[model samples]
Target: MDEFEKIQKLIRLKKYETPGEQFVDEFVTAFRERQRAEMLKQPALSLLWESFRAWYDQLFSPRWTLAAAVVVIGFICGFAFMPRGGQTHLARRGKAPDHPAMTLSLGKDQTGKTLPAFSIETIRVMGEIEIEPDPGLLSKHFTGGYDQIVIVPHDEADTAIAVPYDFIHLDGKPDIR
Candidate 1:
């Protein structure tokens, strides 16, 4: 009538039967044999490789093998039959070919005679470009027309000479000669 009583009644009615000892022994032996067989079987990778080899062998039968062989033979024959000779036309200039031709000779120390990448004057101009002129100096030297001016540093003394109306400003203007 109660839950516990019902459970007890069910437990009593239920057959708690187990297999015979011989049957249990035979089942465990069969299970162990199955496990041993599984352990002895090839790994998945080896099985997959063997299957791939079989598939490849089936795919490339006698016909495919003959076609591949023919392709290789054709390539070999093509290379063997290729023409070998001087393809360039030569001009017979009566003069014998000279070793180390005079035309190929270069002037000695050509770089020494060449002009520098930037002259001293060019460097001076660049130096002037970087200098921010004194606002008082700018007010005195620069007028409304010229926004920029170049200050020349005279080597005679350590004095920097502000060239009036000669400096280059950010505003577009022709070079003051």
Candidate 2:
């Protein structure tokens, strides 16, 4: 077609798709309304994910990028220098404890098959070992002559002296009884 005819055809197509006076405003309003409705109707997990995405996007924004970086670096350095639980008390001071204080004995069931257990060992707490404490409660659990057991008063063991409770990942059947 000639240039004029081509222009006419293009204009005819554009006429049907012309931007309405409130096109931007209407679109924005509908978008915001849909977002609000979706947020209201979304399940908890979806809301959490959306919130996380928003926070993550905010973290990358110019206003928050530097603050987020500083916070991240601070966390990294803090964790890097922190004392880990596996490091023995003596080992932290450049000396390894003699005869590993605590050792794990993989337990076997009465059928002599490996099963689950918290830990079976001489749990070394800060005190002397008592071989069969209190003759009255001595033969309480086992019958084959009580082996040595360590007992610590609650007041002593419950102290807040930097115990690595969270780091105790050694899996064994918890001594529930």
Candidate-wise lDDT, in order: 0.45, 0.48
Least accurate 10 contiguous residues by lDDT in model 1: 116-125
List ranges where model 2 is wrong by over 4 Å. Answer: 1-26, 60-91, 94-177
Put down candidate 1 lDDT per residue, 1-177, tens digits, no spaces.
999999998998766676766998899999999988876697988778988999989999989989999999998997677433211112212334222211111112445563211101111123322222333444343232122332323456435565433233223233434
After superposition on all C-alphas, the RMSD of every candidate to the true structure, in Å, is 27.2, 18.2
lDDT by residue for model 2 over 51-73, one digit each (tens)? 89998887688667888889999
RMSD of 1: 27.2
List the candidate 1 regions with Cα displacement exceeding 4 Å. Answer: 1-4, 12-15, 44-177
Q: What does the lDDT read for residue 93 in candidate 1?
A: 27
